[model samples]
Target: MGLFIFNSSIGRKLIMSISGLALILFLLFHSIMNIFVIFSPEIYDAICKFLGANWYALIATMGLAFLFVVHIVYAFWLSLQNYIARGKERYAVKKNAPGVDWASQNMLVLGAIVLGFIALHLFNFWYKMQLQELLAKLNGEVLHVEGAALVQELFASPVYCLLYIVWLVALWFHLTHGFWSALHSLGGSNTVWLPRIKVISNIFSTVIVLLFMAIPVYYLIINLLG
Candidate 1:
């Protein structure tokens, strides 16, 4: 069964759907948490400490990493299969033709850009928090810079903040399309549920992305004024 999912077209797509849904839920929760950073740094730091390198957090982190790898690998595999199936006819399709959001046609490219930002983000934040905890235990040290300090340091720089906003914009487009498509792939598309799910997907994706984008925008404005 697992092998089939890794190999079959429909099964591969289902994997993408399930993992995409999981990531979307995580993004919603993460965006809410980020909002706290703007509203109350103390409260946000407390929340971060609560989620610190604990057993449950470790498990969730591992699950998120697994999902990311599987979802991306399968996306590439599916795209490759699609290209193969279409054969030379793929070339006949116009590049960047009208009526298509460049993002929709180049999801893989956007995903790659997003992945690059994720690596930078993990290094900037996750490694500082979680890996610092591990190293502190090993070498008898303390992790001083918590969530709020990290956020302030990163967003203090205009260049990094601008890059983050660009990444968030890409994420918005990616989620808007993927969210509804995932539901449809999962058999949520019927006479009644199809249109409803599409609308819900757009609203949910937009809200989550906007919340995330707001954090960087807020900090950038503050830093620029000062």
Candidate 2:
């Protein structure tokens, strides 16, 4: 039964939907945590400490990594299957498809952009913070650093701030389409709910992206003024 589901087209889509939804939930939690940095760096650092390099946090991170890999691999598999099924007429059909948002039609491309930025983000923050702490623990050395200070330092650079803004824009576009599409794939949307879901997706994506974008913008302005 499990193998059958893994081999079916619908089952693949279900995997995508489930994995996408899980990532969305993580983004919501992360955005909320990032918002705290704007108002109280101390509070944000405290929250970071709470989540840092602990057993539970490590487990959660591993789970999150698994979900990302599943979603990405399935996405590429589906895209290839679609291309093969469409054959030489794929572009012709896509060009004629009306009422489809640009983001919806180019989810794979958007996803690639998002994935690239995610690597950059991991290097900028995760590698420097959580991974560093984990390494220190393994080495039997104590290493403590304030999460907010690292954030401020990175965002102080204009180039990094600009790159982050670009990344957030790509993320906004990706989420706007992915959010509704995932729900639709899960049978939660129809003709009646389609427009409603689209609206809700837009609003939700905008809010989440804005919350995240605010951190870099805030620190950029502070660096400029200070």
Candidate 3:
């Protein structure tokens, strides 16, 4: 069974589906927590402090990282496998099939864009906060980790704020397509459920991205007004 899962396309697709959904859930949780930065930064900082350099939080972060790596690997593996299975037909220029959206067709491109932004985000935020704290703890050094202050300082720059908007847009496109695709692979492929799940995907992606986008937008407003 383990070998089948490692070697079979279906099993790889199943792993992708489950891991993608798990990441979506994590995004939802993180997005809601992030919104506190806009309204009540104290709450946001408190939350960050609670999660910083703690054993439980570190464990959860590692687990999340593992899921992300597995999902990414399977995604590339499946894409390559599909390309190989298509043989020479992959080069044929054909019109879009009915019901296949643009995002579905260009998922690899969108995934690449999203992946790039994720690295930027981790560098700007995670490296400054959780990673710094982890390092300080390891060396018995002292450091302040105020995530809210860090967010505001970074987003205060019009350039960074604009970059965040671009990132969120890419993320929205990726999620809207990936959410439905993941569900379809899991069991929503039937005629009755696919369209319904697609609608949910749009809503879910919009809400999560909008929540994350709000912080940057709010900071942009402040910068403009001041």
Q: Which of 1 and 2 is ahead in TM-score?
A: 2
lDDT of 3 by residue, 1-226 (tens): 7886678777787898899999999999999999999889899989998899999999999999999899888879888988888787565677877877788888788888888888998999899989999999999986669888899889879999999899889889989999988998887677887789999999999999999998899999989999
lDDT of 2 by residue, 1-226 (tens): 7874479988888999999999999999999999998899889999899888889999999999999999999999999998888777535443545777888878999899999999999998899988999999999986666999888888879899999999899899999999998899899988899999999999999999999999889878888899
lDDT-based ranking: 2, 3, 1
Candidate 2 lDDT: 0.91
C-alpha lDDT score of every prediction, in listed order: 0.86, 0.91, 0.89
For model 1, how does the per-residue alpha-carbon lDDT over 16-135 read when each residue is reduced to its tens digit?
Answer: 999999999999999999999999999999888877766787798899999999989888988888878877754555667675555667788889889999999999999998778767
Models 1 onward score TM values of 0.92, 0.94, 0.94
Total clashes in model 3, counting residue pairs 3 or more apart in sequence or in different chains: 0
Clashes of 2: 0
RMSD of each: 2.1, 1.7, 1.5
Q: By lDDT, is 1 or 3 better?
A: 3
Flag clash pairs in model 2: none
Model 3 scores a TM of: 0.94
